[model samples]
Target: MQLLAQVLVNGVLLGGLYALMALGLALVWGVLNIVNLAHGALIMLGAYVGYYLFTLLDVDPFIALPIAMVVLFCVGYLLQAGILNLIARAAMFNTLLITFGIDVVLTQLAQMLFSADYRTINPGYAGANFMLFGITLPWVRVLAFAVALLLTLAMWLFLLHTRLGRGIRATAQNLGAARLYGVSPKRIYALTFGIGAALAGGAGDLYGVVSQINPYIGATLTAKSFAIAIIGGLESPLGVVVGGIFLGIVESLTALYIGPTFVDVASFGILVLVLIFRPNGLLGSTT
Candidate 1:
């Protein structure tokens, strides 16, 4: 029972992290209607950025997050404005092809620059942990979890209370009406995509602290994010959190009982179930 409790705790922490990871993908898909196949590549780039900052410049991983985010934001913005804008109104299938191409290009570029070596960001307290109600908690995981929730709340607030946030929601719902209100669909698209990239980068920064990073990890991360996004529903930020935590707990239990090999199988299986029964998602509307 104690072991089960520990696994549950671990799963919740992991779920928070996953929530942040999927948030970017959800944001872009929800607001910009861009599937962003290159999302994971951007995350890989962010992990690399954080890794370098921690090792080369002695910047704290937490502190380096913003830098990585800004860099990816620029990359996302340029991709959207300079390239994606050309096909913004094109078929969703076309967007997928373009994004897939971008993913391939970014993956190759990262491999060329960083090599395929698996690297970890080992901080001074990489192995530090504390006991809580008989469940051991790592400082890094706790901090990452907190940061994830904070960012999620900030994202929700941004969309609810800010001018640009309103503009983004407006554009998402009705591009034509948004333009009538002086919203530049092109600029909004670029900015929305940039924000999504920034979130992915932030997640990558936190991710590097917990796991091994390689150029190839993007594909798996992208798949995981996709599953989480769909399961949670793109209707609200809270849905991402719920989905992430749900998957996290499920994965944690699966790993404990069935072995880690079947974790992905379990996750994707649930995703398929959700799609069949709840096509709109756990929180998405039937309409």
Candidate 2:
């Protein structure tokens, strides 16, 4: 029972981070109707940015998060405006092809620049942990969880309250109508993509603090993010949160009961089951 309790806590923390990771992919797909294959590369770039900021500039990883987000936001904005915008109305196949190409380019570029070495951000208290309800909680993971939840809340509020947020939502629902109401489809699309990338940047920063990262990690991260988004349902951001937490807990349980090596199998297995039974997603309405 004690071990199970500990695993649950750990799973919750892991799920929080996973939620943030999938939120970006969900946001872009929900808003722009574009499944960005390059999202994981963007995440990889963000991790490197945080890594360098901490290692070279002596900046803290949490503090470096916003900087990384800003950088990726610019990258995302540019990609949407300069490249993706050209095929905004193109077929899904074209979008997939173009984004896949971007993913390849970004992955190769990261490999060339940073090599394939695995790196982690070790703050002063990397090994610090505390006991709560007889459960151990690592400080960094706790902090990362807090940040993830806060960011997710901020995103939820932005979508429900802000004017620009409304504009982005409107564009997602109907581009022609959004344009008629003074919302520029191109601009909103770019902004939405940028926001999504920024979220990925934040997640990457948090991820580096908790685990090792490499250029190739992007592919797996992207796949997981995609699974989370699909399982969470793109109907709302909260769905992504539920999906993330669910996967996290499942992975944690699998790692404990089965074996660490079977974690991926469990994660994907859950996804397959979800697809077979609940095609609309956990949070999605059947109607």
Candidate 3:
């Protein structure tokens, strides 16, 4: 019973961060209709940014998160406006090829600068933990989880309430009509990508606090993010949250029972099942 309880608690904590990691990908896919293969590369950039902030400026990883987000946001914005927009009206394959090219460039750049090093942000309180009814909760994971939930909620509110958010939604629904209403597709695309990159940056900051990172971790992170995004349903930002939490718990349980190596297999296997059976996603509307 104690072991089961601990596993559940750990799963939940991990799920929150997973949700954060997937939120950006889902938002961009849902709104901008662009499946950015370089999404994980952006997350990698965020980790490197946080790592350097800690090493050079002595800024806490948490405090450095916004800085990373802002920087990535600008990169994403420029990439969209200058490069991606050229192919905005092109086929999905064209967008995929462009993003894949971006991923290669980012990955090579990271390798050239940061080298292949496995680094983790070990804050003073990194190892600190507390007991809650026989379950141990690590402080870093708790903070990461809190930040994830807050970001998710903020994204939800922004989409439902803000004018820019409405413009984004309008463009997603009907690019032609959106243009009639004075929402430029190019501009909206840039803003959406910027927001997506910012979310990935924030997730990277949290991830660096808890996990080991290197220049190459982005590809795997991107795969996991996609799995969570699909499982959660791209219908709404809230769906990604649901998907992340569900995946977190599933992976945690699988690790404990089957073995750690099988976790990815289980995750992707379920993703396949979800895609085949419930194309809209578990929490997504069927309509």
Candidate 4:
């Protein structure tokens, strides 16, 4: 029973990070209607940025997060404004293809620059942990989880209260109305894309502190992000948290009992089942 409890705690902590990881993808998909295939590649880049900041410049991983986010935000904004917007009015399939091409380019570029070596952000206190109610929580993971939740809440508040947030929601509803509201479709698109990339970068920064990262981890991260997004529903930030925690527990249990290799199988399998039964997600509506 104690072992089970420990696993559950670990899973919940991991879930927070997963939720943040998928938040960007879900936001972009839900609002911009752009299934950014390069989302994971952007995440990989963010991890590298954090890694370098910690290793080369002696910046704390936490402090380096904002830097990674800003860099990715610029990249995402430029991509949407300069390239993605060209085909914004085009077919959905085209957007997917273009994003995939971008992913390939980014992946190749990262491999060229950083090589395929796995890197981790080993902070001074990375290995520190404390026991709580018979379960151990690592400081790094606890901090990451708190930050993830804070970011999600901030996103929700921004969407519900801010001017630009309303503009994003309006654009998602109707491009014509969005334009009528004095919101430039081009600028809004860029801003939305930038926000998404920023979230992805934040996730990557947390991820590097917890695990090994390489140039090729993008595909897997992308797949995980999709699963979490679908499970959480695209309409609400809280839904992402629910979905991420759910998957984290599921993956943790599966890794322990069903063999580690089956973790992916479990996540994907549950995703398929959820799609068939609850197409809108556990916490989301069909609309």
Candidate 2 lDDT for residue 213: 93
Give per-model TM-scores. Answer: 0.98, 0.98, 0.98, 0.98
Please report how far candidate 1 places residue 233 from its true position, in Å. Answer: 0.5
lDDT of 1 by residue, 10-104 (tens): 99999998999899999999987878889999889999999999999999999998899999899999999999999997889999999999999
What TM-score does structure 2 among the candidates reach? 0.98
Which runs in model 3 stand beyond 4 Å of their true positions?
A: none
Model 3, C-alpha of 277: deviation from truth (Å): 1.2
Better of 1 and 3 by lDDT: 1
Worst 10 residues of 1 by lDDT: 278-287
Worst 10-residue stretch by lDDT in candidate 4? 177-186
Assess the local accuracy of residue 133 in candidate 1 as a C-alpha lDDT between 0 and 100. Answer: 88
Instruction: Please report, as a residue range, the 10-residue window in candidate 3 with the lowest summed lDDT.
Output: 26-35
* Total backbone collisions, model 1: 0
Better of 2 and 4 by lDDT: 4
Tens-digit lDDT string for candidate 2 (66-138) = 9999999999999999999999978889999999999999999999999999999998989999999899999
Computed on alpha carbons, the lDDT of every model, listed in order, comes to 0.93, 0.92, 0.90, 0.93
Clashes (backbone N, CA, C under 3 Å), per candidate, total 0, 0, 0, 0
| 17 Cα displacement, candidate 1 (Å) | 1.1
Write candidate 3's Cα lDDT for 150-254 as tens digits.
989998899889999999888888889999878888899999999999999999988999999998888888899999998888878778888898898999999
